[model samples]
Target: MKRLLQVLVIIFPLAVICQPNTEVYLFDLNTTGNQINITNGKNISNNEGYDNQPSFQYENTILFASTRNGQTDVVSYATNNGSKKWLTDTKQGSEYSPTSIPTTKDFSAIRLDTTGLQHLYRYRSGKSKVLLKDLKVGYHVWNSRNMLVSFVLGEPHNLIVSDLKSNLNIQVDTTIGRSLHNIPNTNLVSYIKKNKNEWEIRSLNTRSLETKKIANTVPNIEDMCWLADGSILMGKGKALYHFNPKKDTEWKIIKLFDKENFDNITRITVNKQNNKLVLVAEPETTLKPKLENIRWIAGNWKGEAFGGITEENWSEPSGGSMMATFKLIVDGKVNFYEIETISEVNNSLLLRLKHFNNELKGWETKDETVDFPLIKITKNKAIFEGMTFESIDKNNMIVYVAINQKNGATAIVPFSYTKK
Candidate 1:
């Protein structure tokens, strides 16, 4: 029969290429509430505005930290969108963050000029070279064979090993204090934060400058990202720890939220193509006054985003649930999202929030549009902010909240989500 139907059409396309492809995402750099959902993960290139620190350029092509066009540059993307490049641009100040050196074609950026002092630049093709000037690199990294250049310089915070072959710069001895970076390929694991800020999860050995303090108690580590099954993903205080340095410790504690009043777990990012886990839960105090605006948000909440760009899942889906219903509905202004998800393909659910200071402080959201701008409505809590567009000249700013204190503190925006 025609050679068994040509071997079942070439073995059914290799069993659909060995089954794999279902990413769906739309928020990273830390996903907060106000209806920002993504299921699966990985799909960033819309609202490329305010895009901060994303490495990897040539496969899913990326190199973020952007202000789009009004300033603060360093942009490039090609997850297949074809072209959207701008290596670096600055008529002056603004450039603050950008890191990439993982399997490298070369990348590193920092141009915070204007006296805040931070002028380190190094781009490849489009041209732009500075490397080190004035000095004060807060958090910079580049390894995986881009040569070598780790950071966290001066002012009571050392550990700045440099060496682009022979330019050497050494400064190890990380007794570590106020640091939240340096963990890209184990140069000696990092995520420090001493002097009462609490955080501990260290591992320094700048070839043996020696430093070890892996989890002396993590209540809010806020520093993670080292997974390819090597597990090191973290997020403390409220809960979520998975350390496992080859069985040297903590293998799991996954998720746990509901601590006094939230705020302390500053950041933790990891999307491993979509295993999903991005948090930024911080709120030590903003005068929540007597917050209890909607009786601890009642119930019913869910999150998962990014379902475009050829569409599949993207990365934003993995056992989802969030129930913070009603507090300030129609008669009170607007703040309602009832999302439900399931995907063999698609299940409509979009959320949006982009506020880079429309008087609402700082906010960012992108799942898929949900109208914005409402600012305040206290009784249970309701605050808003908005602004969007990643490409037409970047302009992101999304913030949302509908707090009602119990564990309540749900609407606070401060921009810092990065994924492209």
Candidate 2:
């Protein structure tokens, strides 16, 4: 006898725990107390591009939306440590709303975007397909058991639902308002409305589409997201807050950040891999700046790197100290030096260090040429100020030192020389 299909119960109060490598990443902001750090918040494609929508673990595997490559697309790291790989390929416009499904796999992601104004594409399995088109999609949610999608048409935005098994679509909401998200197991949707100058968090039933008010706060709300445990997480300005629906009150503010030093918290993502949270930070709002070519004298050298190490996409950086040996032979003259640096703990963006000159003044690399602009070779010691340039297009340069303080508690800097 064959078994019949049975309906599974919707599990409520889904408890989510932090994974072993739990990490919090914000932008180049200074975090205090229980604040999560935004370490590596730059576009891997260019030196002066935007690092929008950060979503990844501490292991250097992140999924975010970027337009640095001339197109708005979803990009991910090939490994826990690797270059950014584009997931969606559209030349006309860019993509947005990139979120990763918590998994051990490095490149696993589920991103959605509506670039053409007529379709919404889901980038997965190495390709993008029209998951929902001919409709106005406002927000979407995807999990292991079910998928929730929202769309807007005419004036008001409407919510929709689709089952993965049947590929059927159903409308959930018909209100003309704002943001929406799924609250774990409960068949309800949480949304925000602009009440006066403040925003209010509310809920709507999934079955009946009846709306219910939840919380009302300041107007600083921008990117709103929820964890799998039914705890709501959202960002207003530079700080992150957690809200509890049952208690009708705000929970502990998880990662309150310093606003002056860092950028605005544009988006927040929940990476379930280690139950870690990743926040995308940039200078409140800035344009893609022109980068100069990073220049370093042509020479033979070696180095080593460690500490402040993160697994998924670089996090919890307590030690990013490095040491590198710079050996340069220019115009029959030989000069040698060393550089040591200590990266900001729990932050990969700031690697502070001291500089000590040698026989060589400095070196610069541009247009595939290593230019040593300053170098003085003496009998015993050397004085050098070197620069290395990585041309990220017609304009852009990243500058790094070739020599630094000696003995002073440091290690070899293993700069991953990505040979162009």
Candidate 3:
């Protein structure tokens, strides 16, 4: 008699919870008829944390929010000198969307407090003042010296025009993405409108408060920029594109960076001189690691190891992750348990495990877990940082666990298991 295959279920991380770590890049921009040349490309924000939403404050400076200091804060970087400094250092909250206000020495950013309070704040002279008290601003664009348009967070997030002096907040539209920008030398600012599942880039009359569609974009983009010659450059995935509403019929790839070498290219901006183009992007991801080759290990198995009977139960891989549990039984009594997880991180696969006692109390602290990085993989055998798994057959497998004995002798303990 043979056992039937069992279908296992597990929860995937929420979209809001699992976001890619992004970094910003800079490039020189040049254009011809329908093609653009990008040269002198360099990574501006190389840290691992969220370094995104880059906005050109001057021809030589960019402001963006970064999590390098644990909590997100606005950081200023000089493009020429490679200098950096914290623009906002509030201890109680994380700040985002740092934009330099036109005609002023001050800047503005969205301060997200730990108590669930999000507000637009003005920062200048080492002081901060709340700009909007009743609305939670996610992104904003300065329309003039005293007025600006904002993407206020709500059920679907709405677009609003806020008067800086009077503090009047007026909702202009609903269901908008965060690509807000002021058209060059014009009173119109551009925004993305979510029309059902599709998105359209529209221009808003800052004075009259009217809107007109400029160009329709692919779904779910919040990053775009206005070029000097009336062209719009937008980011989608690893590729960057430019569209001219008057000449071009559709968006075309700018050939700025190779698509295969980049990931999540978004939040683009150009300097006032139109020579420097900057973009926020995550680097180096082709696809997540596939688990099909490791399917032989996805089952319940029992074996003798560590002077005890070890039972291991592994769940099928799904949603870029798999899970397993192991128990060590001595004389028909459980001695210890181990929780194991296999998931993709930073474009690579990793196996993490933690031990627990018979009473289910975790041996590892809440802040730390043992990690095993995938070093190599071949057919039915995979090698981790210091361990390896080899499958002799579908029912038989061996795990070479790296260990060091108390006598200072290093050895590999092979745990051999057969499918139950």
Best by lDDT: 3
Which ranges of candidate 2 are over 4 A from the true structure? Answer: 1-51, 54-61, 100-116, 143-146, 151-154, 163-170, 174-179, 185-188, 194-198, 204-211, 217-222, 248-254, 273-275, 284-420
Q: CA shift at 155, candidate 2, in angstroms?
A: 2.6
Give the per-residue lDDT digits (tens) of candidate 2, residues 1-420. 011111101110100111011122423332343333344443343323444545553344666655545444666653344566776676554555455433423222222222224344555465666656455454455433445555444344455666556776776545434355556667676766555466677776654557777776434474666665555667643446666666745433444343232334555665443244556554332222111111121223222223221111112223333323433334434433334332323322222222223454433322232323322211211122343222222222122334433644212122323222
- State the RMSD for candidate 2: 19.6
After TM-score superposition, what is the CA distance of residue 14 in candidate 2 from its true location, in Å?
A: 32
- Residues 1-420, model 3: lDDT tens digits: 011111100111101124478888888877655446778888878888678888888888999888855678888889888899887778877788899988998999887665455678999987999988888677899888789899877778799998878878788999998889988778899999988868899999866889998888845676788888888888764446668888888665444243223555778899988878888877663322557667777999899987899998999989888899999999889999999988877877899999999999999999789999986555556667656666778899877676765866444566789998
Query: Candidate 3: TM-score?
Result: 0.64
TM-score of each: 0.25, 0.48, 0.64
Alpha-carbon lDDT, every model:
0.43, 0.42, 0.77
Instruction: Provide the lowest-lDDT 10-residue window in model 3.
Output: 5-14
Residues 1-420, model 1: lDDT tens digits: 566445433422211112222111223333343222223333343442334445554445556554545555666666545476776666655554466656657677766543334556776775667765545555666533433434455445565666555666677645454334545545654646454656576666555556676664344443566654444665543334555666655334443332223333434455445334434443323223222321232222222222211101122333431121112123333333222221122222122323333233334354543343333223322232332111111121111323233654333212212222
lDDT of 1: 0.43
